[model samples]
Target: MKINFALSAFLGIALFASCEKKDDPAAANRTELISEKQWILTAVTVDPALPLNGTLVTNWYAQMDECDKDDIAIFRKNGVYEFNEGASKCDPNAPQTAQTTWSFNSTETVVTVGSSSFTLVELTKDKIIDTRVHTINGINYTFTETWGIKPS
Candidate 1:
């Protein structure tokens, strides 16, 4: 009878110790929102002055047409974005691709990868809005775009 009581008490203590309660609401929200799944860049907006001209001529002109969905630059969730890779939009002979990692800040206002950071200017139910200011050498260019979310 004493042995049975000791075993029951030990089991009860083990069960209680194993049970844990999560009390952080912000942490839960971040996990649910930012880390929920993968995202892809659906649209890109570049400075009108830069004008995808010269070497970038193709990157700009073909993407400008609203009816040209096939010619649009496609950025995958894997962090690699393809510009003029598949279609004959710009220079089919010369395709360009850029790669970078993706992450959201604590406030979910900005995303950073390497030396580049995009500030969150707006957001919608389907996408996170961002504006990117890129400085190459001494030249700076700004762009606005929306990143579409994907279900995992």
Candidate 2:
């Protein structure tokens, strides 16, 4: 009887341990999704307290030039982040390649790349939406950017 009881208890404990959850599954998915693809900017929405010519401005991507629309960013598994301007150059003097380091916050809702931090509004296998807020001259500006996986 004693042998049977000990064996049953051990089996029960082993089963319970096996069912335990490991590291956050969502975080792992986010990391994998972000690292696997090169994201290209698809849309941008900008809201500013100060009106543009006395009119509220939104959906700013329509105003972006071909060069501005060609920016691409990539995050690697090794924590290296890179941004490249496509064939066109938004600024003739701007560096073509921008390198940085990136990591997800504990909650995985924020992504920090070098000195800039972006709030992750939405993320999926093929799409990402992030937002950043800045204050300049007492005017609050919010910029929301949407990116899609670049086609191979």
User: Candidate 1 on 1-152: residue-level lDDT in tens?
Assistant: 01121111111100000011234442333223333334444555556445333445213323443322333233335544333222333344443433334545566556554344557665443455566555545667655655565433
* lDDT of every model, 2 decimals: 0.39, 0.61
The C-alpha local distance difference test score for the whole of candidate 2 amounts to 0.61
- Give the Å error, residue 11, model 1: 51
TM-score for each prediction? Answer: 0.43, 0.75
Give stretches of model 1 more than 4 Å off: 1-31, 54-107, 136-138, 150-152
lDDT of 2 at 33: 67
Model 2 spans > 4 angstroms off = 1-28, 48-50
**Candidate that scores best on lDDT:** 2
